[model samples]
Target: MDPKPSARVRSRTGRALLGAIALTALLAGCTATGTPSPSEVPHATTPSPTASDAPPASDELVAADADRPLEAIDAYALCRAQTYAFYPGDFALLEYAPFDEASVLLRGDGLWFVYIEVDDGNRPADLVESGASNCIVGGTIGEPKWELFGVVTRGEDVVDDYDAPLPSA
Candidate 1:
């Protein structure tokens, strides 16, 4: 029998086969020209693009209804933005409590309190290990003269509290 192929040659052939299989899998839904096949092309449901397809203008976002007891989502966004202004670091909002009708009655129209809980994803490893991963932002809807921010050990139990706006960058 002819001498068997060298181990190096066999290994090369195996690697080539694996690469070809991976390439085939990656391009399976495409045509021979490497473009997506007709069936793979997504059909547009609308005849033309809509306004929402584009990013909302900053003015548009700022112009959202300012009434108290806003939709839960709107309140959440307001609180999240306020929180970001304070933190300015990578964090995710964990929860939010929007002022309610009773709150409006006690405070006033357009005067709503939002408590936003956030997870500080960019905290140092030491802080993370020490369970300092969460914080809270408490403020009114339209930039109150003052706001409360702090890291908490237990639910709503603010530990190191701060009452001033973060220095502008």
Candidate 2:
């Protein structure tokens, strides 16, 4: 015999070697996968508007003689007043009007005012009788032409008041 080894000793050694190799392979596989479980995964998200969002759209500059009535207060001017009077940030323009042959007055914040004259070639009448505060003013001037005087804001302050009218000409 040449220092013969027992079968029990050989079997134990083999099992230990196999166990170490299996553990190493398991660790390697985990690293290679590099994926999180469903519980660990994050959910989808929506983007929120930040302070640096694009500037609000400007009001349409139209001719005074066009089918649309003359807007005593423009969107830009309204936005400035809103900023001075209320919040400061991005905002949307809602509505503006002379609409038909109607006279409508908008007033708020000490320095801001809007007065529209919708005339049928005679005296102006107040005809902006219906519509939400935050929308476009839709109607014709003298003829039946449709126009859109969209809304505007300085941030969150609304400029939709008929309490105090601007000076009449």
Candidate 3:
């Protein structure tokens, strides 16, 4: 004859086993869910650089100068004159009238610098004729050791307005 388990013990063991299985299934179900939806997800936005992000330079372009209304001129005529000044190589000049502003890249002493010129409405008549400076307000170059002697006029006249040595690049 074999000894049999009591009905109460067997029932208790069955309930315990079922409870354990249910708990395991519940935990697995929670883990099986996918990532949260867009509305529920946490995210971060990165800020972008703006014009006012950096302090303006000492010789920064004047707002009034930029806002000065420009007059249109013939691109072909301006190109011919700029080509002559920057001879033996192709030079790109903005195709706008009155030569209000310009950005130039010049090489000297085996280094490059970015030069910016703004019209101050005091442009010389000769420069106006050649379409170099309609009205030069301010000009600056980015070369610490390099000094901008002045722009060479059509007749080689050097206009010495700002002569400080550029900051070292």
Which residue pairs in candidate 3 have backbone atoms (N, alpha carbon, C) closer than 3 angstroms, thus clashing?
Answer: 118-137, 119-135, 119-137, 120-135, 120-136, 120-137, 144-166, 144-167, 144-168
lDDT of 1 by residue, 116-157 (tens): 444444566544322222222223344433323333433333
lDDT of 3 by residue, 1-169 (tens): 4488766667668879999999886555442365545565545587766878956642344543444332222222233343344322233322233234443222333322222232223335444334333222222222122232233333222223223244575
Per-residue lDDT over 85-144 for candidate 2, one digit per residue giving the tens place of the 0 to 100 score: 222222342233333422333334223233322112221234223222232222233332
Q: Which stretches of candidate 1 lie over 4 Å from their true place?
A: 1-69, 88-113, 129-169
RMSD of each: 16.9, 27.8, 28.4
Taken over the whole model, the C-alpha lDDT of each candidate is 0.44, 0.37, 0.37
Question: Candidate 3: worst 10 consecutive residues by lDDT?
Answer: 134-143
Question: Which predicted model would earn the best TM-score?
Answer: 1
Q: Look at candidate 1 and give me any clashing residue pairs.
A: none
Q: Model 3 — TM-score against the truth?
A: 0.19
Residue 124, candidate 2: Cα error in Å is 99
Sort by lDDT, best first: 1, 3, 2
